[model samples]
Every structure is written in structure tokens, then in C-alpha cells.
Target chain A: MRSLFHEELETLSDELVELSRLSARALERATRALLGADLELAEQVISEDEQIDALRRDLDNRAIDAIARQQPVATDLRQLVTTLRMSADLERCGDLARHVAKLARLRYPVCAVSGELTDVFAQMSEHAQAMCLRSGEIVSAQDASGAAELQQQDDTMDRLHREVFRILLEPEWDGGTQAAIDATLLSRYYERFADHAVSVAIRVVYLVTGVWMDEQEAASRDHLGGGGVPRAGI
Target chain B: MRSLFHEELETLSDELVELSRLSARALERATRALLGADLELAEQVISEDEQIDALRRDLDNRAIDAIARQQPVATDLRQLVTTLRMSADLERCGDLARHVAKLARLRYPVCAVSGELTDVFAQMSEHAQAMCLRSGEIVSAQDASGAAELQQQDDTMDRLHREVFRILLEPEWDGGTQAAIDATLLSRYYERFADHAVSVAIRVVYLVTGVWMDEQEAASRDHLGGGGVPRAGI
Candidate 1:
């Protein structure tokens, strides 16, 4: 009976990982639709959001059930709780993707962003997708070092985001103000995506090292102000 | 042993209620400081954040310990997990309050909002604080009806938020752009406060009813204009 319970707990973890991957794909596809101005893909992403919601609910229920039936202790309980919290975060990411896709579909014939900005955004989007993928890996492997590296990975996306702002704010871009707003907001979405990825990485770090990183401690560090966005309330 | 476990779990629930109450107070004070432009009060809110953060971490650790030691069943585990998630939400709400306080301090010298609009915002703030208080009550009592009332409570905040837009866009407010921006952002903060309060209410509804409120169902009812915010996925 104990072994069976262990098996069930393991299954719960696997399901959570699967859900993470599902969200990652949704983010990637939705972002691609945004960049390519692919109306079909945007519609597909918007239509598919319910599935993500369904998967999230399933993971939540199963995690609860695992805790009840398996009665996982210590690390296992932490893992289940973390999985549940992470699922909530991931589900919101899916909603954000849908939000992006909806924006794309709403402004279809009038693509506000130029190809130049799209290029920069594409790079940001890809790096953010990579973060999501690595975040899942770190969670599954519980790798502290890899999790630490996720922060560095996010820095690249941040750089690209700045590049986006630089291009959008140029004096020559007067006619593009509306598009600029859209691009800026899209960059925010991507940045938040990376931020959530970093959150997952921090959780992975906590899982392996048993040392939860606090933002207050990090804030105390004298920063050279290299422009890395500080995690809020780490 | 079972009785001891139940007792410890009960203590945890009590502790969570205490933490939630503290959080609601912090939010209220922060809102007041923002609306009244009280820099001293804002500073107090900022300084008091450490206590709130510490309480949050304590509640978190205790919740983890409870789950680890007691090994609760599904229903009990859901309650525990919900508490953990709600604690995070409450902490984030405190963070948002701090955010407002930060803005209040930065935008010092108190720009006066238009008379009628300012009155509306003051009332909105009161309603937000009330929602937070009611949310706490519903959580503690596990009162589904009270929780559902939060949906109604949010409408006032939302209407005030829209009215803020009208105030800002008025032709006479030409020089008030910056103040308008500040007010709009402040409104956003309160709007989100009410939002999270509704979310806590929905969670309570879920806790009691065992039936999760769907976004569509919420939209049909149209309380928060589709009430609950989407859960963020990992």
C-alpha cells in the first residue's frame, strides 16, 4: 500500500511537469503568432485556453488527492504544495498568452509593430520560451545550479526588451505610438513570463538547497545597477 | 495522536486568520496613506512591511510543517493548500500596498485631485478595505454567501475606476496629466485589491462548495465582469 501511494505521488509530479510543458508550448505558439501576425495561430491559441484551464484544475485536484491518499511527508508535501502553486502561476501564464493572442486577433489587419521591432521581440520571446523550458527541467531535476543559471538566462531577455524600447522610443517613430504601446505591453508580458520562470527557478533552488531566497536580502546587496530587474519580495 | 494533529491544524488555521487580519490592516493603512497623501503614514506602512513579511514566512513555514507532520486528508489538505496560496496573495497585496506607498512618497507635495473624483476614490478605497475585511471574515467562517457578496462589493471599485478615467479625460484637467496618471495607477491598485479579495472569496466558495467557479460562469453572472482572476500556471 505504501509503495502504491508512492507511485501515485510520483504520477502527480509527472502530471504537473506535463502541465508546465503544455503551458510552455502555449506561450511559445502564442508568441509566434504575435510575431508572425498569423491570425490562424492566434485563433488557435485563444481557442485552446480552456484546455490549459482544464489541465490546471486536474493537476490541482490530483495534487490535493495525492496529499490526502499518499499523506506525503516533509519534502513530498513541499513538492506537492509547490507543484500546486506553480500550476497556478503556469495557468496565469497561459491566460497571458491568450491575452496576447487576443490582442493580435483584435488588431489583425492593422499590425501596429514593424518588422524591425518584431525581430527584437522574436528574440525576447524565444529566450523567454527557453526559460520556461529550463524552468520545467530544473523543477523536475531539482537542480540548484541550473536554477541559478535561469536568472542569467532571463538577463538576455531583459536586454532584448531594452532593445525593443530603444527602437520604439526613437524620435523618428512618431507615427508608431499606438504600435509602440502594443509593443511595450507585449514586452511587459514577455518580461513577466521570464519573471515567473525565475520564480520557478527560485523554487527549484529552494527545493534542492532548502534555502529560500528572500528579496529583502538581495536588496541589501550593493548593486552596481547593471539593470537586472530585482525580484519583488523574493 | 489524531486529536493532537487536529489541534495543531486548528492552531494553524487560527494563525492564518491572524496573519490575514494583519495583512488587511496593512492594506487599509496603505490605501489611506495613498489617498490622503500622508508621507509619514506611507513611511509607517513601508516600515511595517517587514513585520508582515515575517508573519508571512512564519505562516508559510508553519503550514509546511503542519502538512509534513500531520499528513492531512484531501479536504483538510485543500484547506491547507488554499491557506498557503491565500497567504501568498495576501503578502502580494501587502506588496502592492507598499507599492502604492512608494508612489505616494515619490509623488510627494500632494497634488490635489478634482473634488468629485477625489470623493469617489476615497469611497472606493473604503469599499476596498471593506472587501478585504469581509474576505477575511468569509475565509475564517467558511461562509460561501459572504464570499459571494465580495463579487458585488467589487462593482463599486470598478465603477469608480472608470469614473476616474472620465475625470482624467475632461478638458479642464489639462495640467493634471501627471496627477491623473498617479490617480489612475492608484485606482488600478485598489481595483486589483478588490480583485484579489474576490479571488479569496472565490477560493472560499470553492472550499465550501467543492465546485470551482469557472470564468464563463462568472461572466454569465458578470459580478467582477467575470469575477475571478485566472490562476497563474507554473
Candidate 2:
């Protein structure tokens, strides 16, 4: 029975890795739809987000059932609880990706990102994907060190987020106000996508290194200044 | 012993109500800071967010302890798990409130919001505060009916969010790109603040009605069109 319970925990971990991969693929497709103006891909991504939500529901119910049946304590209970939070982060990643896709759908026939800004968004998408993928690896391998590196990964996303603003506020910006609003929100979708990945990474650190006496303690050092995309003062 | 476990669960509910109240105050003050350009109030809201984080941590630890010591199953286990999720949502409400405060601080002497849009934001802020405060009441009273009403409150916020975009995109918009960007992000912070409140209110609905077979089932109906902010197309 004890071995079965541990095995259940292991399955939960594996499923979390699966959630990461699902969100990563969704984000990749969403970015493609955004950049290429591919209406089909955008619709595909929007429709498929429900899958991530469903998988999360399954994982959550199973985790709760395990806690109920196994009566897990200490390390065991923490793992189950942490899985719930990680699943939530991954689900939000899917939602953020869907937001990206929806913007693509909303701006169909016309590319949402115009000109040199497209390159910045592509770079941000790449970095966000890497963070999401690595979060999965960190969870699967139980690598506290990889989780530490994932925390740093958000810096690139933050920089890219600020770059989106820089372009939006530039005197040469001809994209007009609608584009500016889209870019502001689109940049946030990517930035928040990375933030969710970092949230998952930190949970892994807590579970692996046992340094998380409080989630806030680990999180205090964890802000990549990603939360607020504060301009250099207007 | 079972009664003690239930009592612990009751305390978790009370604390979640407290968290909702904390975030409500934070949103109220943060909106004040944003509209008034009160640098000191912005700083105060930013600094005071830590207390919400700390309270959530305390609540999480106690819930985990309740789970570990009592080894609760069934309704007891679900209530504990829901507490954790509600605390997370309420904590995020505080963070969203802080984001609003940070934007206020970042913009400093110059008001982040400009002209007519200020009225829209004021309405959004009031609506957000109402949802959050009502979420606390719903949880404390275990009022599923009130939770239903809280979900509808998001429509006003969504309308206000779109109004922010409409103003930014209009030909008459004199606010320029920097203000456009600030308004976009600020509108999102308020919209998301209300979304988190809705998230909590739904959790209460689940626990009270036992209708939450899966969180996504209820959440599918819960979108409020708030996630994407899709435009009328470019």
C-alpha cells in the first residue's frame, strides 16, 4: 500500500511534466499564429486550452483522492499539495497562451505584431517556452538547481517585456493606439506566462531543497521585477 | 477529535475571509493611490502587501498541519484543499492590488490615468472592491447565492476594461503612447483583480453547493470574457 502511494505521487509528478509540455506547445502555436497571422493555428490553440484544464482537474482529483486514501503526512502531504499549486501554474500558462492566440484570432488577416517589434516578441516567446519546458524538467528530475536557473530565466522575459514598452513608447512608433494596446497586453501575456513557469520552479525548489519554510520567503527573492512592468517613470 | 479538525477548518474559512478583506482594503487604497497620485499611499499599499502574504503563509501552514495531524478525508480534505486555493486567489488579489499601486508609484507626480478614462477606472475600482468585499462576505456566511451575484459583478469591470481600450484607441485620444500603455496595463490589473475575486467566490460556491465536480466545469461558465480582451479587429 505504501509503495502504491509513492507510485501515485510519482504519477502526479509525471503528469505535471505533461502539463508543462502541453502549455509549451500551446504557446509555440499561439506565437506562430501571432507572427504568421495563421488563423487556423490561433483557433486550434484557443480550442485546445480546455484539454489543459481537464488534465489539471484529473490530476487534482487524483491527488486529493490519494490524500484521502493514503492519509499522507509530512513529505508525502507536501508533495500532493505542491502538485495542486504547480498544476494551477501550468493551467494558467495554458490560459495565457490562449490569450495570445485569441489576440491572433482577433487581429486575423492582419499581423498583430508589426515590423521590428515582431523580432522582440519572437525572442520573448522563445524564452518563455524555454522556461516552461525547463520547469517540467526541474519537476521531473527534482532538480533544485535547475529550478534556481529557471528563476533567473524570467529576467530575459522581463527585459523583453520592457522592450515591448520601449517600442510602443518610441517616437517612431507608427503602429497607432490599437496596436499599442495589443502590444501592451500581448507583452503582459508573455511576461505572465513566464511568471507562472517561475511559480512552478519555486515550488519545486521548496519541495526539493526543503528551503521553503514559507512560500513567501522563497518568493521574496523570486520576484524578477516581472510583476510590475514599471516604465522608466512615464 | 473530529470536532477539533472541523474547528480547524472553520478557522481556515475565517482567515480566508480575513484575506479577502485585506485584499479589498488593498484594492481600495491602491485605487485611491492611482487616481490621486498619492506617492505615500502608493508606497504604503506596496509595503503593506507583505502582511497579506504572511497571513496566507500562516493559513497555508495551519491547513497543512490540519491535514497532516488529522489525516482528514472526504469533505474535510476537500475543505482544506479549497482553503489553500482560496488563500492563493486572495493573495493574488493583494498582488494585483500592489501592481496597481506600483504603477501609481512609477508614474509618480504625473497621474497614470488621464482625463475621461479616470472616471472609467474609478468605476472599475469600485466594482473590483465590491466583488472582493462581497467574496469575503460570501465565504464567511457560506452564501452560495451571494457568490452567484459576485460573478455577475465582473461584467461591469469587463465593460470598464473595454472602455479603457475604446478611449485609448479613439482618434481623439490625446494621452499619447506612454499613457496608452499605462492605461492598458492598469486596466488589466483592475480586471484581473476582479477575476481573482471571482475565483474565490466560485470556490465558495463549490464548497457550499458541492457542485464542483471539477473546478473547470464551473470555471468554463466563469470566464466573463475577461481573460482575452479581444478587440473589434484592426
Candidate 3:
């Protein structure tokens, strides 16, 4: 019976990794769609988001069923609860990716962001993908050791976010107010995507080490201070 | 034992309502701070946000412990799972509220949003508060009937969001790109805040009715179309 329950937990963790991968890839394609103005790719990301949402729902139902049947307690039960949360984070990552895709689709013939700014967005997307895939590895291996590295990666994402604001607030910004809005929203979407990945990885750390890391500080959502708001540090 | 478990469920439900109220009040105050440029009020909301976070954490821990101790199955187990999800929604509402307050604080004595836009923002805040308080009532009563009304309120928010975009995109507008970005973020925060409230209400509808409401369509998140992005509707 215990072995069967362990298998259930393992399966749950595997699905979590799969969710991470799905969300990560969604963002990557969404970025390509945004930078290259690929309407087809953008539409694809938007439609495939349903797949991620469906997987999350299925995983959540199974997690609840396992608890009901197995009557898990202590670490066993915590693991199941944690699975629900990690899936949610991944699902939200999918949503952010879809938002990116939607922005791409909204701009159609024209790329969503200004040409000069694509480099920063592309960098942000790359960091987000790396964080997401790393999160998957942490969950699958049940390893907490990768946390420090994840934090460093999150810091890099924050710096990139500030970089985005710098370019937008620069006096030479000829992108217009509309483009500024797009850049702000786009940067936020990518930053939030990376933040969710760190959240998943941090949860896994708590699940494995039982040291109880503070999840709220998973990544600094407070990192961005837009416009005249004194962008967080140079 | 069953009665005791039911009582535990009731306690969990009550705490969920408290979370709803806490989040609602936070948004109300955050809105006031934003419109009034009240740094003191903004700081209050930011500091009090931790209280909301702590309540949600405590409630979730209790719900998890209840499931472990009672070993509930069927509807009982589902109720516990729903409690966790609803708490998460309310907690996110609190985060959105804090985001509003942070925007306010970031601008100090200068209002985050300009004078003319405050009417729309205030209207959105009112809708958000109504939805939050309504969600609390729905949860406590275990009533799904309010779902329709909640949906209507969410519609109002979406309309207000579009109005913000219209104002930002106006050719006569002279608030500059920084202000446009601020307005954009502010509008998104409020719209998302109300959306979370709608999410909570819809979850209760599912819990009580067992009719399996399609929650993804709880409210249209795809409503906004910014810049040259062809705002969704007139």
C-alpha cells in the first residue's frame, strides 16, 4: 500500500515537470511569435494554452483523490498539497505565455514590441525558460540544492526588468506612449513568468528539505518601479 | 465524528470569508490611496497586507490539517480542496490590492493616476469591492445564486478597463508615456483584482451546485486590447 502511494506521488511530480515544460515552451514560442511577428505561432500558443489548463485540472483532481483514498498524513499529505500548488503556478505560467502570444496576435503584421527593445524581451524570455526548466528538474529530482542558483537567475531577470524600464523612460524613446504601454506590460508578463518558476522551485525545496522557505519572497515582484516611480536601481 | 468534521469545515469557511473581507478592504483603501495620493494611506495598505497573507497561511494550514485528521472523502474532501483554492484566490486579491498601494506609494505625493482617470478607476474599485464582499457572502451562505450577479459586476469592470484604454489612446491626450504606462498598470491591477473575486464566487457556485461551472469563463480576461492592439470593443 505504501509503495502504491509512493508511486502516486511520483506520478504527480512527473506531471508537474511536464507542466513546467509545457509552460516554458509556450513562452519560448510566444516570444518567437512576438519578436518575429508570426501570427501563426502566436495563435498556436493561444490555442495550446487549453492543454496546460486541462493538465492542471486533471492533476489537481487526482491529487485530491489520492488524499481521500490514501488518508495521507505528515509529509505524505504535505507532498500532495504541494503538488496542487506547483501545478497552479505552472498553469499561471501558461496563462502569462498566452498573454504574450495574445499581444503578438494583437499586433499581427507589426511585432508587439518596438524593434530596439526585442533584445531585452528576448533575454527575459530566455531567463524565464531556463528558470522554468530548472524548476522542473528540481521537482523531478526532489532536490533543494538548486535553490541558490535559481535565486541568482531570478535576480538576473529583475535586472533585465529594470533595464526594460530604463529604455522606455529614456528621453530618446520614440516608441510612443502606446509602445511604452506594450513594453511595460510585456516586461511584466515575462518577469511574472520567471517568478512563478521560482515559486515552483522554492516549493519543492520546502517539500524536500522541510526547512520551510518563505514562499512569498520566491522572487521579487517588488522589483519593478515603473515610470517616474524610480525604477529599482540602475 | 462527522459532525465534528463538519464543524471544522465551517471554521474553514468562516476564515475564507474573513480573507475575502480583508482583501476587499485592502483594495478599497488602496484605491483611496491611489486617487488621493495619500502616502500614509498607501503605507497602511502595504503594511496591513501582511496580515491578510498571515490569515491565508493560517487558514490553509488548518484546512490541510483537518483533511489529514478527519480522513474525509467525497463531498467532504472536495470541500477541503475548494477551501484551499478559494483561499488562494482571496490571497491573490490581497496581492493585487497591495500592487495598487505600491503604485500609489511609488509616486509619493504625486497621484499615480491623473485627475480625469480617477473616476473610471474609482468605479472599477467600487465594482471590485462589491465583488469581493459578494464573494464572501456567497461562500458563507454556500449559495451559488449570486454567481449571475457576480458575473454582471465583472462585466462592469471590463467595460471600465476598456474606457481606460480609450482615454489613454485619445489623440488629445497629453499625460505622456510615463503616465500612460501608469494608467495601464493601474487599470490591469484593478481589473485583475475584480477577476479574482469573480473566480472565488464561481468556485462557490461549483461547490454548492455541483453542476461543474466552466470556471475559465468566469470573467473575460481577454477583454483588453491596448495601443495599436485594437481595443477589444468600442
Give residue B190's lDDT in candidate 3 (0 to 100). 83
Docking quality (DockQ) for each candidate: 0.24, 0.60, 0.48
lDDT of each: 0.67, 0.84, 0.84
Which residue pairs collide in model 2, if any?
none
Error of 2 at A137 (Å): 0.6
Looking at model 2, residue B69 earns an lDDT score of: 96
Model 1 TM:
0.80
lDDT of 3 by residue, B115-166 (tens): 5798999998998988999999999998898877888787788888878877
The TM-scores of all predictions, comma-separated, are 0.80, 0.95, 0.95
**What lDDT is reached at residue B8 by model 3?**
90
lDDT of 2 by residue, B105-131 (tens): 888899988799989989998899889
C-alpha RMSD over true interface residues, each candidate = 10.2, 2.7, 4.0
lDDT of 2 by residue, A12-91 (tens): 99999999999999999999999999999999998999899899999999999999999989988999999999999999
Is candidate 1 or 2 superior in TM-score? 2
Compute the lDDT of residue B223 as modeled in candidate 1: 24
Candidate 3 versus truth, CA RMSD in Å, comes to: 2.4
Q: Model 1: residues >4 Å from true position, as ranges?
A: A1-10, A33-40, A106-109, A112-120, A156-187, A215-234, B1-10, B35-40, B106-124, B164-187, B215-234
* lDDT (C-alpha) at residue B147 in model 3: 79
